[model samples]
Target: MSSLRAFVFRMRGGLWTLLFCIILALARVTRLSFLLGLPFVILGQIWRFWAAGSIGRYRGERVGAEHLVTWGPYALMRNPLYFGNGLIGLGWALMSGPWAICIFVAAFALLYLFVIIPHEESFLHETFGTEYQDYRSRTGSFFPKTLPERGRLTGPFSFSVLRKSERHTLWTTLGGTFLIGLKGFFL
Candidate 1:
């Protein structure tokens, strides 16, 4: 990977957090838009929560999975975290305005497509070799493949894992929504 790409892979989480803050701070929520986007946000959170519970806590500032999680949300997509992020971002954008939607799509494509996903894919390939390749082949990055995935699933979900790693996301989701709603209705 290029130095720039490596740097981005390292900073991807912070970047997304920054983006989420920007989105929340600038969001122009309306009842209609908020209602429309609520489902997406809920679904995204559910997805993220499930993924966090399925996979173990993120170990360090590196792209290494302690175990290849191939059950639960992993069965549906290769990058459930990113997929959920996309959904959340899209929902936020939708709540914000049309311009935010455009910005979110562009940023998502640039960050996830060009930098983060590729780097993570490389690392996963290096780490798991054929196992990851097979998993990659079977699963879509954001969704499941057309064909049914038939196999004995591994790895059970754990709420403890979710609590350890994902409370911030939950809190942010709740706080952001509250602020947006408050701003829309009262502020």
Candidate 2:
């Protein structure tokens, strides 16, 4: 059997699990709330774009930050992108109003807490060492500990980052919601 880390990584760092569950649960059941969740799908895409822009040009797959992003939404929460993704899942559950979807969201959150976050932290610690430790000490993992302050270092903000990140996430976010709507409309 594959090891736990292997399995989690295969889940694309737990994103696959949440996306699958969101699609499965919402598509399986039809409801008005699912329609309500449509907006959050768009918001999720926006969050993904902004977070990627903040991080740099590459996707979130790189854990070892060549540089720390202490600006943008990152200034508010260390993991705003992940938190926003969770909100997307939460909105999906709200849209579907399905008990099963709710369970899936809870499961996703737990898996992230237990499986994904720790692995990512270990990687970050190894990568950034003391800098990462200090960031973690001050930053909240999933919530904002304090108000955001403007960044000291300014780099050229790249829309390409948005395009790049959104390219991967948009399909899952919008397409998954579309699939749910399709099921709701057709079946």
Candidate 3:
């Protein structure tokens, strides 16, 4: 189970990207579906940018932050980045239309629930100790239940952090949306 969790956690992003590309290639998108999915994709990007910018100060040359992040979108959700990823994926699935959206979302949810969240929680607990535990006690993993009750607000939003954390995400989202739009246009 641990091995599976590790594998899924490590590969989740790449695997999802590949899946989205394959789905896009196979899908017969319509103008209506593309338009409908556009809003989700946009919202996902906004969420990612907000989370990234909020955590920029703690992101100095490390994957694990020196302190817990609980501001901006983090104030809303424990896993805003994962939530953003879900929205991006759901947007792509919606663009695919029909049963594909259901399958993608189901797979995504299972992956997050069974694999990603557990692995991340273990790491956070180890790194941040009581701070993470208290935060976890108050915060829902994927959904925003309430504003964070603890943790110091980080410094102001940082474009550098946004650029570093989200450059690939932003580019791929735009590219995928463009391809879907092109497919719809041509069809």
Candidate that would win on TM-score = 1
Sorted on TM-score, highest at the top, how do the candidates line up? 1, 3, 2
Q: What is the lDDT of candidate 2?
A: 0.68
- Quick one: how many clashes does candidate 3 have? 0
lDDT by residue (104-169, candidate 2, tens digit) is: 567777677777777777777887889888877777988776655555234446787777776767
Where is the poorest 10-residue window by lDDT in model 2? 147-156
Q: What is the C-alpha lDDT of each candidate?
A: 0.80, 0.68, 0.78
Listed in order, each prediction's TM-score against the native is 0.89, 0.81, 0.87
Best by lDDT: 1
Q: In candidate 3, what are the lDDT values of residues 51-168, reduced to their tens digit?
A: 8888766332223666787777777778888788888888888888767686777788788887778877887888999999888787788886676545533445889878876888
Worst 10 residues of 3 by lDDT: 57-66
